[model samples]
Target: MPSPSPILLAPMEGLLDFVLRDVLTRIGGVDRCVSEFIRITGTVLPDRVFLRYVPELLNGSRTPAGTPVRPQLLGSDAACLADNAAALARLQPEGVDLNFGCPANIVNRHGGGAALLDTPEALFDIVRAVRAAVPAHLPVSAKMRLGVRDASLALENARALAEAGACELVVHARTKTDGYRPPAYWELIAAIREAVAIPVVANGEIWTVADAQRCRELSGCQALMLGRGAVADPGLAWAIRAADGQAVSGAVGWTELLPQLDAFWRIISHHFPGRQRVGRLKQWLNLLRRRHPEAEAAFMEIRTLTDPAAVDAWMARQRA
Candidate 1:
């Protein structure tokens, strides 16, 4: 039988950075991860910029837990993106991912991200350029939404990326206008899968093992990518694997999750400055509250404190 599909961690810009990737991958069950989009605008960014966004590049492009990370690039200029991809390739990332799926207005307004979804020809050019620039052994992939305003051009866009030599395609089952609302249209991914020859991974709104199973059923995709859902419950990937009869542990209860939270705090404290530290903890606690009641209480307790030392003391108390 074919091997079970891999569970990938989505590259959530601003939310899933290297620190969180370290924590979650340490929790186990993720097969691979895509780093947040490194915007390639007009110029070829310096090595520091790529290393800043994905420090894993310094460690052989693998997280502290040893999971390979593919750095994703977002842009509209085919030549500039190609140049940036070449620079990033020299850093030896596991792979390079092209982002055609970000829906942020700031990104769209600049004619990047999901804005390229409106033009299949642009998608073709961008992916083709990046693919040609990177070494043949290194994989080049693309992630895209169903379309911009609607699904009318979804198939065309998928075909363009596939024809342009994208090794794999991740379809985030919603149009640009759909935003993050419910009902991620997994069935639409099925159509995109049918249109493309490469592996199509389904993404969007998969919060639990049940959602994962249902998405697999509807999209006819074996692979699923987790985003906010994984952030809320770091063990979601492990739980999904266990549900599939893999010899793995299941859900990480609040008590079991505390250690990982502590680790997350410790890393951010060392890497981020005092001013940004507490907000990073709060940002995660806000999402953790979605899955754990204890996190709600923790969030409320530290919600008012701007002092990093106060947050540190509070964390120490929790560990106690």
Candidate 2:
């Protein structure tokens, strides 16, 4: 093929924060990373909040490893979003991403995230406003689900975002109601790709290289964004890239990943408290276990441990 194509790290709230983004993107093959959703409420949030969400904005909008970080905004009010986008633009992000795809009940109840799918006009207006507010050089992208309850508005929603000047869009290939059920409906992305002229990135249900190839063929989307799968298999992007092109024999096995795990623990413990670090490490370890037998064995060793120091010691032993 013409090249493996660009892979983006999805903005998964709570899970893929700056720390995770820093660790994961460092593995390579990921072109860019979007920040955890910056919750825009009734008014424009201050710069500190944006900085808190995307610390990389201060570092040339890049991870320590050099992957560009795009800040994602989530909310319903067009004016509030636009105003916040303007403030974010001042901070010089690579781009501003709008989140219309989050399925969290808390987000929807607060008139943010997938709730906007119910009112396509509001989604359009929000995009239009943010697009107008940000500098012309900066890109304005959007992420959305197929629809709220069904695929009924998929085309309309895609068209609305494209018409409102979303230079690129990422479709999660499922309705808000699907809530990550089996079968990500990759075919739905094809209709979205056809509906909009801007680049349509296919997301959801891509857990392996084979799945990536199938998603590319099925969605007809050159760009693919990875979420949980990337977390579970840190070397997945490299493996996928190698499968299509030059061989990348980097960090595939669990033993090979121990150093990375230790690096993550040392980096995160500097900021997160012992209990929070314990929880975060386990959260990642749980996801990691899905792909690596080593992670499963490691999790079993630390599953009941509530102290970060104990967890650190366990990881040190693994390294030894």
Candidate 3:
């Protein structure tokens, strides 16, 4: 590993919110975390949106636990993105990251996220403009896929991004067509790393500490950005940091997991009280489904409970 370790929390839009970020960073090993993409279409998003996600900017550019939290932006208009970058600079974040990798239908259709990759010329112009807007001390980085459809354009796209003055790039190593499927082919990240001048962070399919190690060795990039892997096991970062032969944390059974799960809902509940709270819980449950069979049952129970207390009770009963 590279000194303190090189794991970063991926900039997952809805999933990597403020509280979730807090939880993961506290896990001992994660060095950096990027807030969900702040969509800047032209209008400057309110300060609350920035502080709500990037509270770290308030205290020197690093998250409360000391790991840096870079704010990410997603949009198509170069001028708008440049303006947004300039505006956010006043906050003095450690860095700003460009989101050229989001595959969401809404973002793609608007030509804001991954859709820009389809037009490499536009992508080049946007990155160059944003680089010009941000201060030299603050790094401008990017996260991208191999291509929108197949992995054909990965090398060329990576070269264009690097040549455009981006400080570094994180290659997710899969085409947009792969979505979040298996076999992320981290080896492709090695190819991009060799092709670029700046540091390349390897992302995708890193579920365990061994996986991270293998990714680094196979991709020749020790820097890793965790997406779903971090979501499934929030303690992963700390484990990776310890760098021991032992697994960092133990698996919680349904019995022991209920209280922690219930507590998380409470935190989310505060932000989204009532219907707002319920919606957030549902979204989190969707991620839990991949790791917990009872997540489906808990989600079904919570879907109609409406009452937060009742939802907690139902979730508790899901214990194995």
Residue 37's lDDT within candidate 3 is 91
Comparing 1 and 3 by TM-score, which wins? 1
By TM-score rank, best first, the candidates go 1, 2, 3
Model 3 regions more than 4 Å off: 1-4, 242-263, 282-304, 312-320
TM-score of each: 0.98, 0.97, 0.84
Which 10-residue window in model 1 sums to the lowest lDDT?
Answer: 1-10
As for candidate 2, its clashing pairs are none
What tens digits encode model 1's per-residue C-alpha lDDT throughout 1-320?
22378889999988899999999999988989999999987999999999999999999999999998999999999999999999999999999999999999999999999999989999999999999999999999999998999999999999999999999999999889999999899988988898889999999999988999999999999999999999998889988888888888656889888999999999998999987888888999999999899999999999999999898889899999
Please give the CA lDDT of all the candidate structures.
0.93, 0.90, 0.78
- Candidate 2 at residue 147, lDDT? 92
Candidate ranking under lDDT, highest first, comes to 1, 2, 3
Query: Candidate 1 — which residues are off by over 4 angstroms?
Result: 1-3
Clash pairs, candidate 1, are none
lDDT of 2 by residue, 1-320 (tens): 22348888998988999988988876777888888899988888889999988999899999999899999999988999999999999999999999999999999999899988988899899999999999999999999998999999889999999999999999999999998886999988998899889999999988999999999999998788999999999888888888778567675778667877888999889988889898888999999998988788888888899988788778778778
Query: How much does each candidate deviate from the true structure in C-alpha RMSD?
Result: 1.4, 1.7, 3.5
